[model samples]
Target chain A: MILQLIDIGYLVAVVLFILGIKLMSHPESARKGNSIALAGMILAIVVSFFTPGLNNIALILTAIALGTVGGLYSAKTVQMTAMPQLVSFFNGMGGAAAALIGLVEYGDLPVDDIGKGSVLMASLVIGSVSFSGSLVAMGKLQGVIKDIRVNKILAFLVLGLAIALAVYVLLSGQPKPLLVYGLVALALIYGLLFVYPIGGADMPVVISLLNSLTGVTAATTGLLYDNKVMLMGGILVGSAGLLLTLLMAKAMNRSVSNILFTSFGTAAGPAGSGQDGD
Target chain B: MDAIINYISVNQQEFYIFILAVFVGIEVISKVPTVLHTPLMSGSNALSGVVIVGSIIVLGKTDPANYLALTLGFLAVLLATLNVVGGFAVTNRMLEMFKKKPGKK
Candidate 1:
């Protein structure tokens, strides 16, 4: 059957994704890895069209066309120094997609399945946070947003509120429209506040964290739909993002928590001081 | 609570796969030097654009009357597409700089 074939395609894609990541670790093979990953992505997309219940081909094509043009233009022109910001922007987009998928699928779920609802809620929260957080990160890197020093207490408080909202939404059982919107709004604000205090010097770590968030979001969506490829892709990206974040932190000799909670590159302290001249 | 437990049990295989991937992901990128970190980051950014598949699926399943889903799905696809295209393009541009010229020593 076509379904079996599609699943097989996804399996192949997953293998290629893993291989691509493995190859990308070295400078010598990184480009080849990228091409392999690209081919896998193309294969996945092509196979998804054959999935049962898929429709609205025109709209899909148009959206993809527009995105391709914009992505190509920006990627071709972005400066090396600004590459981090560009990555942030791309990560934000991925987060947005994950969140939007959750939103679209929200209405179709059964009302009694609290388990599924909770999973969806988690995806929405993480996806929204990553999306907005990456935007702020992009702004900071571009010097469009000032690195205003926020009190450490305020940042923690906001983060606490976001977590609380997530818990409330998950436990509420039924999808109250108001609660969903409120959770999304609070998450967005939390994301902004989360990255606001962190200085620009720590952007690589921040981007990595957000990337992991997107991966988590995607994986949750896969769980909701029981889609193997989505789940595999999400898990792969999530793990990769986590590894990258840790590696970047290690290279800088800073812990993940420190990078998240402490403000660097502020007028109060010079950058790279924590490294102890490593 | 029971429902949550059941759900987790149902997807036990997924959790196992997730754990395995985590270890592999960490090990694979362990030896990358600091100089290549940015490109690695950018390259992974493009990979994250895999979310486009989810968006396409969502949009494809929804009815046209569901304008909200349609609009959001469209935006999601567009944004994810941009991520993939731009991320890959920029990553390639960065890598190109490291390549030696044909006549260079």
Candidate 2:
């Protein structure tokens, strides 16, 4: 069947992704590697339109156009120095997409099928945190949010509140999209509080943490769709993010909390020195 | 007419755009000094943390349809993680070189 050709394209896309990562390991080949990966993504996306029973052509096309235009403009216009901010935004987009998918699936759930509430709720939690946390991370990198210390006890209190809200949502037996939205908003606000207290140098670790959050979101979405690919992909990403975050924390010679609570890389005081404020 | 539109859409516009974007990104990076390349690579490699998360979820899926998908996804994650680690190592090495004393005359 002609539909099988799309599988071949997918195969090529995967190959390109692997090759691109390999090429990117070195300076000379990094450009080619990135291009290869981009090509793979393009190919994969184009082939999606040909998938059998994909009826929402108009909606899908609009989303594609919007994502493409936004991505292209941001990639082209953003400065090299602002790469961290751009990375944060990209990670946020991934999380937001996953969250949207999860929320959609949540809405369509049958009344008798509230069995996997914990997994679904976990997805919501991680997705919300990633979306808002990435934004706050971006703000820290951009200096929009000043890097300063917050009361540790206060931070814990807020986190406790988030947990309490999450428990209530899970136990209430009511499907409240507004409540989910509220959780996301609360997470976003809390992200501001969390990342604001962190110094700038710790951005890489924060970014990686957010990356892991996005992965959890993706895996949850995968469960909702009964799609193995999404689940495996999410787990791989999440694990790698955790590993990278740990490595980065080790490199910085700081505990995760120390990185979070103190100004790590803020431009305000002897920025890039990395020797102080630890 | 519909067939023709479909053919052109597939054969002409999308591929051309893809090719153009890739080449342009290549060109922009080419113009920059090679030194920036290592750090940039390190940073981007770090960002590929997303790819790893994406792949692991695929691997963890219990569905049989994703066997090949899971295998390939794991491979991608492996390579990406290697790049992240290797790039960082290279960056740290580069930084250390800056700290070394010059040879005496």
Best by lDDT: 1
**Model 2 over residues A1-278: C-alpha lDDT tens digits?**
76578657655754564455445545555556556655654554455456554443443444345544555555556565776676676666665555544454455455234444555666666766776788888887888877666666776676667677766766676787777667666666666667667766678789877776675566566455443334433543455455556556766676676576555434357655444335
Candidate 1 wrongly placed segments (more than 4 Å): A265-273, A276-278, B101-105
Query: After superposing the true interface residues, what Cα RMSD does each candidate give?
Result: 1.7, 15.3
Chain B TM-score against the true chain B, candidate 2: 0.47
Please identify model 2 stretches exceeding 4 Å from their true place. Answer: A1-19, A50-52, A111-115, A261-278, B1-105
Angstrom error at residue B92, model 2: 21
- Model 1 Cα lDDT, one tens digit per residue, A8-100: 998998888878877777878878888888888889889988979888889999999999999988888777788789889999988888887
In candidate 2 the C-alpha lDDT for residue A62 amounts to 46
Give the worst 10-residue stretch by lDDT in candidate 2 chain A. Answer: A225-234
